[model samples]
Target: MKDLKEQKTEPVQMARSDLLLSLVKASVSGDKNAVRTAVEGIIADEKGKQHRVLAERLTRALHTNGNGTRAMNQMAHDTGIRGREFLAELTPRHQLSDMVLADQTRKTVDQLIEEQQRASLLRSHGLDPRHRIMLVGPPGNGKTSLAEAIAEALAVPFFVIRYEALIGSYLGETANRLKRVFDYVRTTPCVVFFDEFDAVGKERGDTHETGEIKRVVSSLLMHVDELPSYAVIIAASNHAELLDRAVWRRFQLRLPLPAPTEKELAVFFDRHIQNFDGKPGIAPATLAKRLGPISYAEAEEFILDVRRREVLSMLETPLKTIFADQIKAWEDRAKPMGQEESAR
Candidate 1:
């Protein structure tokens, strides 16, 4: 009787201690939701922190599913967490919404939902409009990240298909590989993202060098046209001008992800600098002013990198040298495309 009483009291004390510690850790880590969820789960349980119990059950479920990443997702699904919510959790937190632009050319989650609804209505009425979208944009403008975010929003598996992986270096092998890829998608409900889609679907021309590209494009067209009604396909490219006409027809939705504007860059800079310990004289306005013509990713990196250089400088050395190096790195990478064009 004495032993059991002691054991019961021990857990209550431990739970309170852990709860306080977890709250502090979550705050320090900037994981507010996690802290809230943990507190709520403890209150609901009305006993101890359920971390070990949940972890054990999760491990058992993984064993049942062959212990793979897919198994973990399946476990999440089995536990009543929606697949889309799970995917969203898998995405990096910073690029969730603030980084994305609200504009006509780009598609928002709201717009994608509307488009899907319309596409469904048309298909029900026997007008099979393709939901296969193509996003064209420059590198580092968040093309691939946007694709993943969309899938995360939709709560579906975002499977990225490398073009090189699909195209074999042999006669008729490309088509065979494509068939296998399409076949896998048929079995899995996933958002299929084809990055560098131009490599496989570029338009053909009079040149003899276009033969291989032509054949691959034809195979792509056939597969896309035959894709079942439920699948969502997203193909991305930096070279939109090169996409074949036939392939364009297969994509009823065309979303162009443009570079971030000055305002968006400012938002990115502020959010990133929040975590940095900097008394650097550069105010947000001054940093934003210096970030003219730079993309959001560039701006975020610039602030954090400069802050890091500032914080890590030797106590004896002048800070100007470190600041100069940061500016030099940014200028080297941020030279406008007009310079490259003029040099040519």
Candidate 2:
């Protein structure tokens, strides 16, 4: 046994906090060689403990981040959307309220990091990691907002693939236009966000569908398969089933975003209700009961719309009365069926 003076740090036994501290030290130093050396040291010392796995993970992370940077740089040169402008472009159109994150989209940003690490691993290993992800759910949910959040989380370029720019009427032209996008992904190590994926990657089975879509799909698949691990391709479609199976397969991970629950709605309203001057006649619990099947996006819009109506009201009225009609309509729509159904 080793003497008290020569203590052994168990790699496998290391706490998550310790492992993360090791990683932070590695990342902050900005030296891959140093990170690699530190990881190696940890692995060597804690060969039988929890630290070994943590070291291995940290090594992979550093490698992926480095490779992702290279791929993003190449992509920038290819697409001409790099540097400060690219960062600015990636910023969200609307800022996310901290309350909203807590209320509705908990752990979303964390999930994106996991996704990015997966993407980076694929790249480091010379495999095409489908970073192209789409969030599909009802409108007024935080799909687009989540996209921005992902960009911020990864600290990479985020570009909104303008649908109009890619959709063209000319024959064979649309596919060619899409090539520019794939080229951008190849050049930039960033997230290419397609807000409404269905609009672009529509079903190719229809008779009215031109061969152009088929070609576009083919091009997209080819590029998707060829994407280096560092690039992320995220597409959000309300109708995911409509996407081609091949397209679906290309994405390494598919997260199904669902509507907010009553608890979530209560949290959502609790945060935003403060904006109103007077008491909101409807309680949060009541609002939550009414916001059934409401997506994160809808919840936000509803709050904003309510505020707008109250502020713009012509007559001086109690806050509750000012928004009485809308509240009633919501309540009527949300009336309980008062029945229990078994599993379908």
Candidate 3:
């Protein structure tokens, strides 16, 4: 009986080993699709439960890379109304670590990315991963950047919904455009970002809105509800209060990104200075204190402006003097009273 049992198990073990070996070879050759196929075969064989878990992780990684890189390549091939008219696909070059966010915000974003990476494992256990996120904040406060970072972290295509193309002048045309955008994203794993979300997601009962806008809102609600779990949906709004009440409930995660704090500003300046040159002539803490209540985008622009001036002048001026002059100019432009004075 023992010999018969051993004989039956030997072939199954050998097949599993062969499949794993093939997976390794595929990985070594950078054939992500082949690696996924091998992992799928192992999952199908069900010879070792522990091996299945590892295989699932490997399969997910390969799928992410294969889909992401190939989708980027195929973006040019999509010549239809959905591709050319209503949506623009992008490949994000920024990662989460590249941005300077608050500790809590950083943790939340990290958790969201981790959940996406483990989405397959969650689905295997009958759990749904959080894919729908609502980003609410003032303009230039990193809402769009966060969306881009999410795409990079997931290794997925980033699709931005263009309201100009989506909001049609004719009756019912906008809904048709919306459907096309949804249909395009449904075919792949992507981060579909709706910047200036208030345009379409405004409160349905607002008296100022037209009947067509109302219909669009209803259609949007239905589509949001029906979006697949594999596709990530991110909607960013400068005025969260303008969004429909129903819209708020549809998102699985809601994050409010405020302007950079003093500490974050210091970190941002330090990072930019380090990247520009190995040494910093002016302390980042001093600059951070001087640039009060600036957005993350503004800080980046300021750094770039300083770098540009330095390069243009061939380092003839002292770095401290240049930085101080730039800060004073920025402060004058940012202040309403200073603008009024300058006009006179």
Candidate 4:
């Protein structure tokens, strides 16, 4: 009889052990929601009042994870709008060295490093970091890439705001949604990125705009002000002129991304072709200079296309011939656009 009772309890004990293991795994993986859920399950299964109470305490502790953002997390939960849907969690794979930036852009990167270090020390001194930043330039100039690099350097959760999902058709709904996002940010340490910011942050005084847009802008400005310094807010805009003047003042660091210079172009081309076995007969400097003014994104695309063609040909053709042929094709495609620009 004693042996049978021990056997019965052994399964229960084993189940409890599994639960504890799951909780530890979830915590280590930075899944706060999973941790909370597991704790709740443990509390439900626990027979003793003391054990249940202990489990409840653990659940509460897991809610914030020492970030003091429990209130914001709770508010986000109460809103019923899933924060994960609109806020994409990013794990950066690229480092600063991988990015080829211009001299002015490099200065901005240095400033970001300084701010991050200062923020860490200031937290101990009861102060916060200057976390608000703005990236302005034409499309495909590496604004988004810079934001990712900053997030990686800071080692924080990178949350990109999906404007399409956040914006609503109903009156006042958009403002409410925006408020929830801001509330969540207040409770966590993350890099919140708002790409294509002009969609919602346009000038309020435009005659073509409606009252809804004005209210949305007001809500955005208010949230920007209320956000804690622990959360880094990075907004990117291709049309910087469209943004409200009030919005411009909110960002502490404003970095402008420009088209790649001749030197940058050469470096980019060299990096792209470095891994390939075949040598481009033409020098990278000559090709880069001939390519004219193009964005880093365009250069990457051109190099990739050239490489793809070379691979398809079974490496029979020299890379230099392939590079020259690709460049000529691209130039021919752009000739019409260039002519139109000149006509204008």
Candidate 5:
């Protein structure tokens, strides 16, 4: 019996080792199909060892079926982008009315949504709906939100490119990863968003930049040019000045979302506070005056902080007290650079 068990385990051990080797190779080479095959092989090996429950558990976690990424998205099974970690695919829920925007920006978004809705009609007229979009703004000023809103308005899948995973240091690696992203999105009608786009789209003319960046930019622009209007590409940059000159021309719409003025902040404040169970005791205009110009993200954070204090206090503290206490802390945190600590 001991001899029989050892002989039986010998083949299983050998198969396990081979499968693990394949897994390592597939992972290092970034081969998704090979990884799947290796994992399935391992699962079979586990089953051969009479570890049926463990094998079934491992098989369940492997997400071998087409429904792993997006259960309802038929495109997941149809494309090679399945299981890609660098692309976060989502069904956007934000509407245009969810956030405040400048009048012109809002109108342009509305127009784009309308154009996309009537895209077939436009195609019949031998025209493609405008799809390439560039959003320029400071951090936390609704650039990302606006992209999501557009995708939501169009009722399309929203794909956010994860730069951390997409940017590889190896020669030609980054461009290749970017190409895969564009190819994947092109297979289906979806909204692809590249946030912090200046990271890849930086000016090729910059004295400090390397040839690698220039080549990457060239590759990116080529992909953008070839992308069909059916797949919308939205890229947001904090430093529009840093983007390649060619990148600007590639985008059909380059929208600027600057920091909100005091008045605009007040309007945003009024709209934002309406959702709260209790309104802020301080008026929007007065709060804006005291807060100075800040990103909508900061404004929202301040509001939430005040609400947190209010909630923790069990509504014992007045809204006025909460606002007065939090505003000083908010100012200290948000003060302009080069301002002295004492002055702050």
Candidate 6:
């Protein structure tokens, strides 16, 4: 007994001028590519609404623009080379101020930031900014954070290279995907971070490695060389010794982030713990001394654990008691580096 009107599909939510604002922005930007992309998006949207006549008209209009049809045809052919296939866009949340660095590291990072901010001035005098960086460090340090912060500092798009999506089972697949990655980033300025870079950039001369590894390394370095100055590549590797000899030459700056000292860890912990509403009962330095050697990541994680436990306690446990118990528990679980190696 339903009415005939009820049998109809729900109205297209965006049928009434929702895409017009995008069209306006694209038109004002004077970027033909952006305008074309916006128009095509509208066409697709309209087609989904069963507005076949209107969609056909929009398509005809788009085709009239110089090279639009040809460009779209090319796009259709290379539809597999999508940014999402090998890249993940990240929100640039961290800034240089958000991290604590050694004196030398801070100075170098500051210089790079200055150079990038004044890239136009440098280019006018026949200079290119230093954009190729190799971050060598132990795991659990601030390598990834540093890359993200640099992108934030420069107000650029931050993209992390997804090895999971990029690596293929077929021969020559990985290199092709890497090339596609470089091809997409070249069109615009961005921070392209290759974390755990040694996975593909291993030493070519290492006979223990496969021929495919050699090929991937070669392709990776080639793309690195070809990328424009505007496209910053920040490659981080824990096993720096495993990277190719040629790979070492490709980077403009090779920075190291070593394991933190007790004082340094304490300082880092203090900065983080102050952010929590339930402050630590003991001083960060005292707590850090109790925890022994640890990475910046571990310090942050410890703070999180303390905060979580404190919040869940619902005011039953004193913050000081909770803080002391956490320190003891964490220390008990963490083995000495030598003991871990021996056990292995």
lDDT of candidates 1 onward, in order: 0.61, 0.62, 0.77, 0.77, 0.79, 0.80
Local error of candidate 1 at residue 13 (angstroms): 48
Position 302, candidate 6: lDDT:
88
* Candidate 2 local lDDT, 1-344, one digit each (tens): 66543333332234333444665788698975455444443443343233556645643453454445543233433343322222224565544443355423356546557755444233334343346565767666677777777776666667787676667789887676676666545533567787787776767786777788878888878877766445677788888877877888777556656666788778878877876778878888787776577777767767776777777875366678755666666666665565223322
lDDT tens digits by residue: candidate 5, 1-344: 99999875664355456568778999899997677656665664454356878877775566545556633323433334632567998777567887778899888888998988766455545566899999998999988888889988877779999998989999888887877777566545678999999999999999899888999999999989877676899999988889999999999998999888898899888886676676568888999999987898888888889878988999888777788899989777776677876575
Q: Please give, for residues 1-344, the per-residue lDDT of candidate 3 as tens digits.
A: 99999876665466556667878999899996575456555553441244556655544443454545544323322422344467788878677887888778788888888877665455445455688999999989899899999998877778898877788899998877787677556545678999999899999899999989889889998888866666789999999989999999999889989887898899888877777543445789888988788998899899888888878878787777778789889877777766676788
TM-score for candidate 4, please give it: 0.73
- lDDT tens string, model 4, 230-261? 57899999999999999999998888887778
Best candidate (score: TM-score): 6
Q: Write the per-residue lDDT of candidate 1 for residues 1-344, one digit (tens) a residue.
A: 99999865664466445556666788689894555444443342231233556544543443354544354334333333221221222342333464556566444545665544344344334443345788888877777777777676655556767554556788877766676676445433357778888878887762645576677778879888766544578898999888888888888777777787767666666666566443444555666767577765666567667666666764443444554577677776778668977998
lDDT of 6 by residue, 38-136 (tens): 666566555445688998777667655475545454453253347546899999767788787899998998999898766545554556679899999
Off by over 4 Å in 3: 1-84, 278-280, 316-318, 337-344
Candidate order, lDDT descending? 6, 5, 4, 3, 2, 1
TM-score of every prediction relative to native = 0.59, 0.60, 0.73, 0.73, 0.72, 0.75
What value does the lDDT take at residue 96 in candidate 2? Answer: 42
Instruction: Write down the worst ten-residue block by lDDT for model 2.
Output: 79-88
Enumerate clash totals for all models, in the order shown: 1, 30, 0, 0, 0, 0
Model 3: colliding residue pairs? none
RMSD of each: 15.9, 11.9, 11.0, 12.2, 16.0, 12.5
Lowest summed lDDT across 10 adjacent residues in model 5 is found at 70-79
